[model samples]
Target: MTLQAGTDTALAATDHGAASSNDYRTGTAARLAGLPVETLRVWERRYNISETARSARGQRLYSDAQVRRLSLIKQLVDEGHAVGSLARLEDEQLRTLLPAATPAAPAPARPVKVALIGDALVRRLAGGGRELFALDIVGACASLEAAGRLRTSGAEVLLIELAELSDAALAPIAALRAQLGAAAVVLYRFGASATLARLRADGCIVAHGPADLSQLVLLCESARPGAPQFADAASIALAPPRFDDASLAALASMPSDLICECPRHLAELLMMLNSFERYSGECANRTPADAVVHRDLGVAAGQARMLLEAALERLARAEGLALPVADGAA
Candidate 1:
């Protein structure tokens, strides 16, 4: 059997007979369901779920009938069903039961494992309602790629947390988009900005409010079976970035008197300055390299340099002298 990205590909393949008739040896069932081997044992021993015949060596071998039952059990569990309750369910009962729990409210779509990247906002919004595989940005992307290759839980949409996105995080996001194409790419930003606009231009659907986001996801899921679509929900006005007092205090306390202005220190400072300068030039040129910093740093032209200067001024005032980088030498 061959594997490929997207569930449709697998469903379209000619190996359905082979997959359905495969023997349910211990490892085979677990491999297909992507569940733990120990889970299989627990369901059988503790829950009386899977009844298997043992060989002379005492190894359990399940029938194809058992494998199909176990596969549904895994899907249900992954969708957040209580394992104990599901283990008691027969195959017919489980199928009737899954549709209600799988969808957010109405019709149950096919089981598509989505990898949520960034903050816990997506979890809170969905309220653990769907079969979501939550992973950090890095892990989520890796899982998406793997699922695409395996044709099991291929990512149909990405729920990205812009507030949590760092300068380093953009590369993986870009890679995912390049790999997945103009699929449903949902980005949640702190507020509306040129940065969000840029992301939208690069084929992202931007949502600034949580309410709007929840609705947008519903729409995207609805559109999945019908047509490829895009939305300019970026028109939704949003508030500016706000920091709490504790966060402000923490930012204030970061630069210390230990920041040496020696030649070595100055050299490092100059390198950083030069790097930022080069980054700015590349950004102006609209090269792919510019996106490296654009997504990771979220730095804007004109204002960013001035902001850096202002920060150094505050640091110098706190330290009671000119900082090495602030001086012309750096």
Candidate 2:
């Protein structure tokens, strides 16, 4: 009768009681509910949706019923129900409002040959293999070194779970793709916005967390040979600011009072442009098509840096100041 934060509301009747200590953890619950851990905490804090148990160390332990309730809430929210209104509804009442759960799509004719790089994801998928009949996990490796020694596994797809994106991490993945002739490489990570463009440029399919297993499975199904690559126009459109002739002239003719500030500002702008230049080069080298876009971006950044340096030199001359040494120049 009483609904508590982190406790199962609707599925409590089926389970006949509260969640046991050995049930789902906060991370597992977040994955199952298709919600981030931070979002889960906020829901508990604000709505008291489910009551969770605590471990000796005070870690939140979610029961199976609680996870199910959270999943239902996510589904309802996706269907346009506000969490504030649904927070007070009982399981039966919420179920009445929800459309009947649809059956999963039938498995593909040929099971996808998948190689997993993350241990946690491998365990989750291996444990629930029956639920994902469309995927045939051929290999699971903790690192690229292990993947290199794997013999007799013809995995067509690579599923990489990374904590963050970096050139170092991607180098090995590129080698793996070339070695295995992989048809697709999917990346799963949280807070991927910062590196999403670079990852896409490297021909990766990115899934930002906390994504559900079903969603991950769907990504595998969708990643196929000759499939259209991922593109985010807004992210790609982000480039260094370009100044017109008039703006350059205005900066060149700035008042003597403000001319002193020009060099420092130009130095900062040059640093940013150089950073983007490196990023574009990395992306361009990833694949052939990537060369087109990233090359253009790199060229633009390089030209901007040069022009800014020239402007800085002019400003210095106007103010009778010495020119700062340009970055990477003798």
Candidate 3:
């Protein structure tokens, strides 16, 4: 993400012979604009959202103004505006259409108590604690050992900074969540599609960057003790759909003997169902325009998983194979 900010005309002058502010390559522009490179290209070709210039070798470059315009478009799109309607507007006109930026709301009377779990996160909070005044920092820890102490530190939220999206990184977070019981767990990490999906599946509210303070605050504010865990609708929309009847039928049709031999397979299916239920609940909390598609998909997955689990359990019993007692069973 280039930090340079100026109109295209000014940038053009700089390109010619003046002091040069860094111009962004297409990839960098995409990051700054919060759009995929392909989406950016489509907007340009279909909507002419921004005009691009080519370098000597034909690499596309975006001026800061163009990146800003793309960012505005993305913000509006997320807010439920149609791209076709917004595409033709000039930058200044689009700005007028956007809701005015408001100051962050004052911290709630009883702010969510947060526990910090990374050196970088600790430093970041220390530097800009004001932006997160809505959260009360009850404890700070750099390692799992220190994080363990948070259980008794009166912290109601665990905010962990993760370096990657791998299972290894997630394992400790899972442990923390389990240990803390009702405490809400939030993860901060920069990840690709796969990682983000996994994080969401695990019921973690994820922020892609440290600078996403507002998003982080919203997640914290939404956290409630003993509340059902759920995936964000945006995250669910990005996940591959899992409720196809054919797929569920194939899974159910597996030989009873084979399924019984690996009883953990049934257990894993139950876990998947539990995860999807949380996602379904989360989808329900979102606005209809944002949540409808994902909410319907989540409900479908939950229904399919539930039926499949029942069918498998019947098959196990019919095969005279005793399944392990399920959690919450008397």
Candidate 4:
């Protein structure tokens, strides 16, 4: 077997094989399906989420149908559905099982100031899309270049629609946003992954487009900043699992000289916190709109983990129990 670039790429040659535009290799499928490659492989081996077609060399390939199924499964999983329960579901069955769409958020105390761009989008909103969010429309334009008159709007948010995106167009977009002295919510139907990731990293709000009216409203609301302290995700390097499941079980069950089983209780708490922290991190990657919320959860979990680990260490020492290698997180 040959290996290069990364494990997934090495498994698929550039020859394209019998793959059509709708067929995707492991990495693309994982990204589109919002799953890690390894996790997808495991699901294939265990749940066989659905039958997948492999390339000539035996490398797995996911058809467009399979990718869609995985995306649905991912959404359901995030909503608390167990993977095992969903794995056996057919695509249409999964769709029917999905809950009703997320309701629009309640309007804020004071409507946010926003400017609209794009004639069709503006017209659509004019017809009623603007009602989805608590927003004050200060200006309207049909294109980015035509947005010059908007400089006087004193808008806090700029909602622009892009039929397509190009890297060269980014600089002008950035400069225009700077001139308006406002944050932006960019809606696009298509763009290069790297370009989109770059835009996101620079604090610009982005969403798939042409978004439905409610989605547009959500994007506009996202431009509004949250509390100052939580503006960015807190930086905390969480250590790997401190103890395996078996180790934890053993620690919890072993007879202790202590008056109460405080250590056992603490161990349980630590396990819960650790699981939640990792889940938050996964959600951050899978859900673009709620990335901030997940990041916040991950940080809070890390803090809790460190404190609990310290308590666990002290109690373990008091009982003269051998502990795992120090993670130094406490």
Candidate 5:
């Protein structure tokens, strides 16, 4: 779920907790179904996935049935179903598309082959003087270029560390993954929330980089499929704001040639995100666990802000409106 959706629904969570036990607003439905709100909107716009109902107040709402249906579709899409194909399935037919659940057989024991990146993480592991669990370090190197020289192609895991992460880091990292042929990756980052969301969305396992050796190893272990990725469990948290209050206000008030409320609405959404981001930071001060949770929330919020900001920018450009002063992530 996007930070917006997560915060919106999380604030309004009900007691009933199952796949299909509650009516939900759009954001809540998206959160429960594990789909981004934009993706949900796209599916509805392009495929008519559900004939959603409206509340008495004229707000769109999703039934428990619709939420469950979307969840099933999301799982299928993650497993490689084309969205268009799944959109055409009837509710009953869609249920049938899900694989039958059976008892999970114990996985065969084998040492995981892992390639390491980053000198600090490597030294941290080595400096700890610990024997890792079922892990075989195939190649340990300081940079992706050096790893290429190590010839650890087809390694099962890629464990990397970065002092700071940005959206730009993904491309090079992806290239390294292709070269190394790593099936799973664990990233330790003291990085931007916006970057973390994009990374998580692309299916990378991310963790706070300051963890001790044992914790880092466990994070790598969680990267393997079905091992309960903690980063995934963390989910993307509340996001930080990209634009400040004044900037959003100016953008919201700008005179425009376009005949729509979208620009203003986008600004309003961003203001809400900004408020929540600040709220999350304040929440972080209470305890260590809160710090982690709020940090994730801030990351989710930052990512969400970036998405809305792009939309606002496109509209501003299309309308030839004067833009507000730009700002960086908070």
Candidate 6:
């Protein structure tokens, strides 16, 4: 697909070659001729004076050829030749009449900002494509969060990296899902185990591997049908409901901040749930009311604790992480 200006495509196009600063003059003869820059533009528009060159930053610059052309046009205007008359001039006549002016070399293209992220894996995926937004390792999560926030604020998908998700970063994922809603898959890279599992849980079918992504880029470019869409596993077609609405609400409302602030607690919780699931096949869904009371939620815990823990488990299940021990998992 043809990339739009101000998009990553435009940025990449401008960065292809470097140009020297002295190649073109900015506001040179326009200042010397006591003419506003707009006047020069008017002559180009009205009289077809000269072809303009653009700078890396997208500024319009006048080449010496253009300056000489402008000078000729200005003199003609001073001598009372209306622009309408100038347009009808023969190319040979114009060339003969206008003095030779050395053309300035065009400026270098601008650098692209695709905002890529990940290990060698992400760069390989890019495959020499310009204007990638790059980030690596933990930075991938940070980029995802930033992209998620920007997408929520109506920003277009300029950069995306999906190699950074961990079992620990579910809340941010949830937030991104909630914001992107239907359009989320257009810019996302579904290449990790956690990402794949989450997509599966959501009932979304995402293509696997880097080759899949390269194919996707080609498909988009070709305007072909069958572009991949991530399935929402939460839908009825996927794993049916393990927890009801009230249970999910409770989980979302819990103090999940502890996941970020207290990594030690998170580690202990993950370990406990892993062991519990291994032995009992019970998924952990909630935080117990008292850390001291390790009750089998399905058969024992207080009703209040059961409800709370169930919610947390639902959130975890959606993200493909091990569920916490709660009434539902047990």
Candidate with best lDDT: 4
Model 1 per-residue lDDT tens digits across residues 21-111: 2333455455455666677777777777776776455666566567667777777777789879987777788888777646322221222
Rank ordering of all candidates by TM-score, starting from the highest? 4, 2, 5, 3, 1, 6
How displaced is residue 149 in candidate 4, in Å? 4.0
Instruction: Please identify model 2 stretches exceeding 4 Å from their true place.
Output: 1-108, 190-195, 226-330
Ten contiguous residues minimizing lDDT sum, candidate 5: 5-14
TM-score of 2: 0.36
lDDT of 2 by residue, 1-330 (tens): 332322211221211111232355555566556777688888888998887887665666677667767877877888899998988988767778876674222221344567776555554555552235345565566655456654325667787776666656666777878888885555555444546656666666777744566777677767756445445333444334344333444544454555256655675676677778778878625455467767677776767777776786777687785543423443
- Give each model a TM-score: 0.29, 0.36, 0.36, 0.43, 0.36, 0.25
Highest-TM-score candidate: 4
**Cα lDDT computed for each candidate against the true fold:** 0.46, 0.61, 0.58, 0.67, 0.64, 0.39
Clashes of each: 3, 7, 0, 0, 11, 34
lDDT, residue 292, candidate 3: 55
Model 6 TM-score is: 0.25
As a whole number from 0 to 100, the lDDT of residue 198 in candidate 2 is 60
Which runs of model 1 end up more than 4 angstroms from their true locations? Answer: 1-113, 122-127, 130-152, 164-171, 180-184, 212-216, 222-330
lDDT of 6 by residue, 1-330 (tens): 232222222112232211232223334445434456577667667766555677767755655455455555555556566766765665345545443563222322212112222233333542433212111011122244344423222211122335434544455545555554421232333445655556435433244334454453432222212334333322412122344434444443455544353323333444444444333324442333222123333222223334434554555665555433346643
Which candidate order results from sorting by lDDT in descending order?
4, 5, 2, 3, 1, 6
Per-residue accuracy of model 5 over 129-239 as CA lDDT, tens digit each: 223423555556775445555555345778877777776678877777677666545455467776776666566777776776567667677775556433642565534
For model 3, the local distance difference test gives 0.58
